[model samples]
Target chain A: MAKVLMKGNEAIGAAAIQAGCKYFFGYPITPQNELPEYMSKELPKNDGVFVQAESEVAAINMVYGAAGCGVRVMTSSSSPGIALKQEGITYIAGAELPCVIVNIVRGGPGLGGIQPAQSDYFQSTRGGGNGDYKLLVLAPANLQEMVDMVQEAFDMADYYRNPVMVVGDGMIGQMMEPIEFRTPVKRELPSKEGWATTGTKGNRKPHIINSLFLDPQGLEDHNIRLQKKYKTMKENEARYEAYNMENAEIVLAAYGTTSRICKNAIDKLKEEGINIGLIRPQTLWPFPEKAFQEIPETVKAALTVEMSEGQMIDDVRLALNGKIPTEFYGRSGGMIPTPDAIIDKIKEMLGGLK
Target chain B: MLNDKRIRIIVGHYGSGKTEFAVNYAMKLIEQESNVALADLDVVNVYFRSREKAKMMTEKGIKVISSAIGHDANLDLPAISAGIFAPLQDETCQTILDVGGDATGARVLAQFKQIINFMGYDMFLVVNANREETQTKEGVLRHIEEIERQTGFKITGLINNTHLLRETTLEEVLKGQALVKSVSDETNIPIKYISAIEKVAQTIPSDVDGEIMPIKMYMREEWM
Candidate 1:
């Protein structure tokens, strides 16, 4: 297929349909509204269903119901909208349902502003809802990666029988970029026949989908089982890109739109004879801690940059584990850190190390 | 040079570079016309609106009118400024109305249909063949019909402003020109301008239907 320029939100909608997602339920929100709008228009043409529910809460529950039917189902929203969907998301996670949830993050503890920000790192990675559960979170830095990850998110959700979240900032959702849909490698997915709540005739037993467990022991066992799944994901699914790691004086840790900015800064620093590397995590939940080990011995310090006031820095600290002196630089309230600002931060951190 | 119409309303598919073209057109018009006003009538898209460049345009003496709230207001509320009426009413000002993208975006123009039609404004549908919705001649026609239906106004001109951001090439521009040219022939809507980045604009042959409008990418950041 020829490459076509697509807005990130519309590309995600197209990717979901191409991935055989037959059901979509979402509400309108800035930055990510285009996804649902695109789905509402195109899904029906492909013999699928698109529902604009009354609210994000209602939309996520609709996703829960659709996923229980063993169909590829998804819902998307921005920050506050995603927060509204938390209860439903936890239910979907606890029920071990396969669905894709996308959060095109904007700033806020509460309706911060419609511009891009990476503030939802904790909400997505650390479980916003009540549970001993984990969502397989994929954070894509650009549109092409976002498209690829969104399609793959459906497969990973089904294979593991858990919800997978593809998180990007508002910039990623709003920007236009050239992208081509490629066929993803098929996974050895478990058949949904045995577990799904598809109506059974007299020939088979009826399947139930529920997150509630009255018995304490039953809930404990369920929690343990979910933890085991998360452990497997951590071992197998953690992904990151280690750019210019061959020999480096400083390393930058960032993701999503911030990572792209970091790459530009790294290139500029290289021109000035300053060797800096970057560790961009593609998967945020299975936090890609393993990539930190690849940091060169010449590295003087590690700096974590974000569009928020350092939420992902916690994960970076845990991943590095005192291997190197870790520092943080960030901008919040919908402010994006420019390449020059990032370079200055790197230089400042290097100077401090001296 | 653009059309002689006093009011030029720019409409197109989302990300078809309408805002970029509108900004460039206003700047170009300011060189000849003393009173130039750039009204951002876009209520659909929150980001990348021409109003975001209000300060710079204001510094350059172009009257920048955006959301009803204010020029610096970053809220996504669908409130357009009533101040737009002044420029439309002003006989001397060359007003560029940068409408939002798609039929949804073009619907805003309907609110001004009476004044626009009465004043004899020129509405141009900017076409980018690289955009998924406007990739084919049929798609472009569908877009035009929808916009015309929404606004109850006929498209008088076509602006081929196709691009893939900074990665735009001469071949890409030519491909877009071919698509828009076919649409022009069928619709009889004259090709008003073939807008491209300065580098690609220089490479386009004179045989192309529209006068080449070499534009600077003011809307996008350097790294974008």
Candidate 2:
């Protein structure tokens, strides 16, 4: 099949459909509206359901209802909208219902402008909702990756029986790039016959789907189980890309849109006799700690760049664990630093390290 | 064939493929000269606008002028680039204005009315009959009237850009062409061109009312 030029949001939505996610529940929000819009039109054609719930809160709970029924279900929203859905998300997480949630993050804290932003890092990686659970967060840097990750997210969600998030800023959601899903995606999902809240029949016991555990001990046990699953995800699903790191003296840590700029900066700086490389984390939750170990013994420092002030830097610091000097630079409140600006910051950081 | 209009303003309802037409048109115009500029005057939609292709267009020697604030900025605050006037004054260059999608989006063009009037420009209204609101001649004219009223500009020609993304078939093209013909008959405005994907373009009936503009689906959803 020939490559199709697709915007990030629509691509993700189509990927969801092709991934066998037959149900989507979401309210419209900027930078991510194309996603739900696409679903509203296409899902029905595939014997799927697309419901525009009254609110983000309502939309997520709808996802919960569908996921608890053991079907591939998903929902998406921007930052503030995602915040509204957190309570329901925690419910989904606690219920151990597999579902895909996409956050084409926009500037936030409260009704921030509808622009590309990475300020939701802490909200996403850390539990945004009140819970001791983790979402397998996949941060895609480009349109193709966004499509691929969303498709994978559905299966991963079912594989772990946990919620998965494909997080990116407005740039990834709105930008157009060539993408090809040459072959159809087909994943063997776990059967929900034992746990799904389907009607009781054939002398089988009724199934209940609820997040509540009034007993402290049982809740603690559930938390430990979730932690174990997270540990396994960190060990097995941590994904990152190493670019030009073979002989680097300075490494830049970034992800999503900022990482693309860092890659550009690395190329330009390398042309000027500078030895710089990029460590791009494709999955934000499983922070790819192993990639940090590949930064080479000759590297002097690592600079973390983001659209947020300094959220992901904490993860980079944790990954490095004082193996090298970790520095941070960012432009927040819907502002993106230019590649040249990042190059200058890298030069400054490298100079300071020396 | 559209070479006669050096300054063409493209307008349509949202999802009518106006930006796709504008981008492709800009690419076409640049084949004759390097002094071409495509101005993205779309403040209504933050996504799927011509500015998203600015970098690619620039690399191909066509200047892309977008919002004064920035191309990547998603804020709905409407503002035009001051540099847009340069192409308007430059008779040597061909400039295309990709106005926003609907009457609400077209309202931004009113700000440039004075200059547009002084310079004289041709405006094309793109119609996709597949869109629910514009499925009929009455529906198409209703939107055209609203856009004209909103921008105080008249539509000089019509572009039948009817498509269902990659699923667009020859039948769909012919159906849209017929609907566009009815619209042209009612308004007496010329059907400037009819668009289709490369394969469907080859099957356009010989007696179709407008010139054939075979376009690749540059703006698409992954399902296509």
RMSD, one per candidate, in order: 1.4, 7.7
lDDT of each: 0.91, 0.85
The C-alpha local distance difference test score for the whole of candidate 1 amounts to 0.91
Worst 10 residues of 2 chain A by lDDT: A177-186
DockQ of each: 0.74, 0.16
Q: Give Cα distance to truth, residue A303, candidate 2, Å.
A: 0.3
In terms of docking quality, model 2 is incorrect
Report how far residue B173 has shifted in candidate 2, in Å.
19
How many angstroms is residue A115 displaced in model 1 relative to the true structure, after the best TM-score fit?
1.2
Best by lDDT: 1
Interface RMSD per candidate: 1.1, 8.3
Model 2: per-residue lDDT, tens digit, A242-336?
99987798888889988888887888778998888889999998789899976788788888899988999998888888988888889987787
lDDT for B29 (candidate 2):
72
lDDT of 2 by residue, B22-131 (tens): 88887877887778989999876776678878888888899899988777766666778898989988887788899887798899888778878888889999988776
- Candidate 2 docks with a DockQ of 0.16
Q: Which has the greatest DockQ?
A: 1
